[model samples]
Target: MTYYRTYENKEDVVIQFLKTRTDRLLKQFDEGNYQNRYEWYKEIFEEILEQKEITYKILKTPQLCAVALEHFNNFAKVLLPRVYKIEGDSTAMHNRIIYQTGGFVFLMSHWVLDGCRQSPEEMAHLLDGYIHNQ
Candidate 1:
């Protein structure tokens, strides 16, 4: 709290924290080279699982859930195109990205809420299956 004294409210603090965390993950994703998108997803899932407590708290909180979803949306927008060939009508592409991102977040939220019963590798494989089938 003291470190974030500049923020006027809790929402602001959460937003800033999410932005920073998302930025770091994006940077790592961008810098790393992987044989496939699954590898990238696995790495990210591992990182998130390491912080499951905090993530669960954020997802459970109504206001913070919105913030988390927004950041996840932004993160997906930047990361997805790099791994997939996303080309089409502008509106259609945007909607596709939103759905894809939302689905991924939904899976993650449920996984965290359910105590992350699946390992990160398993989660990545599941997500890969979804993406591959699409």
Candidate 2:
């Protein structure tokens, strides 16, 4: 029941898209902490995108890419298993990202989304369907 959402990148900087909702997602960014390591996270997302160029195959097939894009909710998980949830599964989170490029779009959730809490992989799968078929 993840209350998923999707939006076009509409910009070159990935952070802009991510920042689109930092206010609601992050507890500190509003306090100005995001600025401290903003560049780092942005670079990380960009680097992962570049290293996984093979994934771009989805872009060509918008049908498939659209399916995978649904997993966008896992964006929070991108930095999950973070300092707070250090004991959880990070690799699991990694498997959740929905890779896209340009003014690319992805998904996200309203805290707790659909009442039924979701795993990173589950989120990815939902998007995968759209990415592969749509």
Candidate 3:
């Protein structure tokens, strides 16, 4: 199936997909198997915002969340391929990431942005460097 670009409502879709994906990814990460990766992402995620509360940001966090959502859906352009199992598909990125049998795990979380810090491809490159221990 071809992944169509719904540029208008893409971010909302991606946010929904990511929120859902994060829930499941947390489980895998909590387990012993992906602990390293999980911790690594958590560290990055925490470090990125310094554990600041999104609510206090006065729309910043929510705006970032919204931006992140859009980024994810736009990223679905190539992401749909790396994804192992896509039970749901949409212009929103809410249901995007699922740690299935194969594919790069970082790609999933990298897209889980708080705002437009970086592009998915850029994040993928960074993950590649990290995964290879460069």
Q: RMSD, each candidate, Å? A: 2.2, 15.6, 13.9
- lDDT per residue, candidate 2, 69-105, as tens digits? 4434454444334523456565654543323321124
Q: What TM-score does each of the candidates earn?
A: 0.86, 0.27, 0.26
Model 3 Cα lDDT, one tens digit per residue, 1-134: 22355434645554554556554544444454433443444543443344234322423356655566444445444344433344445544343343221233334333443453664445545655654566
How well does candidate 2 match the true structure in TM-score terms? 0.27
Candidate 2: where are CA atoms >4 Å away?
Answer: 1-35, 76-134
Please name the candidate that would achieve the greatest TM-score relative to the true structure.
1
- Clash count, one per candidate: 0, 13, 13
- Candidate 1 stretches with Cα past 4 Å from truth are 85-89
**What C-alpha lDDT, on a 0 to 100 scale, does residue 50 get in candidate 2?**
41
- Model 1 C-alpha lDDT per residue in residues 1-134, reported as the tens digit of each score: 67566887767877887788778867876776777779878987898898899888898899989877887888777876765667543777688789889889999989999999999999999999997784
Clash pairs detected, candidate 1: none
Q: CA shift at 9, candidate 3, in angstroms?
A: 6.3
Tell me how far candidate 1 lies from the true structure as C-alpha RMSD in angstroms: 2.2
